[model samples]
Target: MKKLMLAAAALALTAGMGLAQDTVRMGTEGAYPPYNFINDQTGEVDGFERELGDELCKRAELTCTWVKNDWDSIIPNLVSSNYDTIMAGMNINEERKKVIQFTQPYTPGLPSAYAALAADADIKGGVVAAQTSTIQASHVAESGATLMEFATPDETVAAVRNGEADAVFADKDYLKPLVEQSNGELVWVDGFDTVKLGEGIGMGLRQSDNELKEKFDAAITAMKEDGSLNEMLKKWFGEDSQLFE
Candidate 1:
């Protein structure tokens, strides 16, 4: 459960305000496709998080706007008030809760997986790449493997494809699609271990923003009880995805 830390984790310390918040800023790493990415046609952020964040804002009576941030500085900028909430595909976990509060999860969960050029690449005790400050990177460090950190998820995948890394570890939702699209260039390593966590993904906010958290938490509860969240989960993450809440 990442709730990703930026490279400036030691420097990052960060909140939300609730007041029918006029144009609440939704911060995201727009390079992560499907979860969040800049739409080439409009040159604006678009993806599951974009759609989900907008709806959550509506239900919470807050007006929302998108703010794109680099993954490395994402948390620092949030602490600096560059945005009101982090809607990046961040997982809910203890490591990040110390600095930022989170609403109840919106998506059920996502699995962390490994991808490499070979179908049988050895993930254990082998070089693996992951986005810097992510859970996958931390997992790699603790596992009997060599960890290489990259500034972006794309670079991690590229590292494996170009022989800089033996394999790349990232969210399965993200890597699975890439493996499918890669033809035979890449594949998920058989028997590769994954980072284990039961937590779902949540929206990051300031720890002091209790009211804001309550507002979003209630909105999420409504979506789950009515099954709309699950419907969207299937649309973006496939029918097997667990329901939100």
Candidate 2:
């Protein structure tokens, strides 16, 4: 009996140590602007997701580390345990939910807009160009436009500007800057549909990690109630932002 009690105590001690050493590793694309972009000079991660990660760590009482991963590889890396969570501005959709768990949405999913360069004199109305395999691509395909698919957002934008494609559909947030930069070259068509866009973005975790998901969900709720989440959004997206308002 004495030996058995000693063994149990030793096992408990080891379990506690293992729990204490656990660190939450978060992954992001580190390319999307105002969401999870990396600082060009410091190579340090910075953006809304970084700030949100810090807030999540404070709430969960866990040490947090950020890992940079390419957008295309993020889901695979998460499944492989290359990271524990994903904070990139990834939309939570039924398709994605089939593989991973997502916390409560932090931002409201807004519709993407279709824009075309004014220089494209041959193009008549709103047509379609999009990054391949993206939600926007599907939207374009459904609209009956010959889908001009590209590898990246930059390429899609260039396609429209260079008249290779009539228009490009992208998230309103990303499209805003491009339209502004076009200096009157690109214009948003007023009637582009947004019904197919998925739900808002959220943190992605392994499907089996319910404990971490609960903790993160609770933290997000607390932040929303206390105004910290709104403050963070304002800091990055500007005051009068509509995301959480």
Candidate 3:
């Protein structure tokens, strides 16, 4: 009886993993709102990535499903084949491409910004918070400021609220909404230059998955040719998000 039970459990686990690999498992943090977040009402992944990924999968004729992962482990899990692709608003930076390949960037140019509790604060030579393994963190580390890395975006923002850090650097589009909702608790500060990082945001895939990469890249291109991609961008990021074409 014990051997039968153990075999059943193992079989179930293997079946589930096989299903994940058969269908394209779209991995995301589902914590970054607007870009990606869990809709409390629906209890599902609902945001730009959710919608965009669904559309891309449809265009590419692939069966895709969402998989939520921690921000810190996002890339590592992708490499380990825990999920098929990463569409977590990940920028197509050279540093990241060394480990994984990326489809054409889906997002238009969006700059990183800083936010803090103070209306005016200097980030120069001061402590700044950023999510670990992000471009923002790398920039802060090289800058004159002391860099404080957090595993999550919320924690990075919390560092500023707790006075542990002077400010948190992140995508302006993501931070702007947070600042507005803070009710005077947080304010945007001029701490960094609006430098272009990478091509833009793209879907991450294992380096060896050239066919998968081609499929997504072609799907993105098709969306660009059609007006559907632009409509999606407007719906999620607002009209401020320009058409990729």
Candidate 4:
């Protein structure tokens, strides 16, 4: 009976290992750009995360596929096993660490900035729009501003353009191109200092999936060491983006 039990346990362990090597579903919000977004031209996931994720999978020798999830439910879905990993520009922080594990940061801490129609727009006392469940929303709530939460990042920007809010707070990387392309209609809010919240952006995995997390962490490190990661950052986020070195 003892010998039979050992054989069964060994078989179960092998099966678990095989399952771990199976296709990794990478979850992302196909909206945020310079990070991840649906390329209208390809009708598929594109942008920085898409490129970086594919390369990481290649280095990790993991078969992976992209899965789109709304930003608000990204973490919940990840924990529920709707996907194997989150590459949705999620920041690594203590609050999130309680529920999930994070791979070492892939990017340095990026600044969050406020955008508005006018440089003089009131950000501290007037209404500020931010995506729901985001660090920006939490910051706005605590900064004595009236916080208006939206379901998507685009909605937050729309709130500013539509006169619904005085300003929108979001990642500076994500907001830079928008301000430049706005034909001077939109500009960075003057006197509003950009803030870096959390540690940095990292891939989120389930607390139980240490093996998978290790694979990604190793891949990220390799990229950083090879300088491929820095090149990609500059390509997507412009030359001014922070580098690993």
Candidate 4's TM-score: 0.92
Backbone clash pairs in model 2 (N, Cα, C under 3 Å; residues 3+ apart or in different chains), count: 0
Q: Compared to the true structure, candidate 1 yields what TM-score?
A: 0.88
For 1-245, candidate 2 gives per-residue lDDT tens digits of 99999999999999988775468899987876778787989899998889889888889888888898876678889999999999987888887899899999887675677777643333234456787656678767776678888766778888887778877777777777767777798887655523438888899999998998999899999998898888887787767565565
Write model 3 residue lDDT over 63-144, tens digit each, in one string.
Answer: 8988999999999999998999998878888899899998988887668888888757768778999999888889888889
lDDT for each candidate structure: 0.84, 0.79, 0.87, 0.92
User: In model 3, what is the error at residue 126, expressed in angstroms?
Assistant: 0.5
State the lDDT of candidate 1 residue by residue for 126-222, as single tens digits: 8999999787888889889999999999999999988999999998888878988998898878876345553778999987778778988999899
Name the TM-score of candidate 3.
0.88
Off by over 4 Å in 3: 1-22, 191-195
Using Cα atoms with residue i matched to residue i, what is each candidate's TM-score against the true structure? 0.88, 0.83, 0.88, 0.92
Worst 10 residues of 4 by lDDT: 189-198
Prediction-by-prediction clash tally: 1, 0, 0, 0
Order of models, best TM-score first: 4, 1, 3, 2
- Model 3 global lDDT (CA atoms, 0 to 1): 0.87
Give per-residue CA lDDT, model 4, range 175-236, as digits (tens).
98899999999998886647789899999999999999889999999999999999999898
What are the runs in model 4 whose C-alpha is more than 4 Å off? 1-20
Which model scores highest in TM-score?
A: 4
lDDT of 1: 0.84
Which residues of candidate 1, in runs, are more than 4 Å off?
1-20, 193-195
What's the lDDT for candidate 4? 0.92
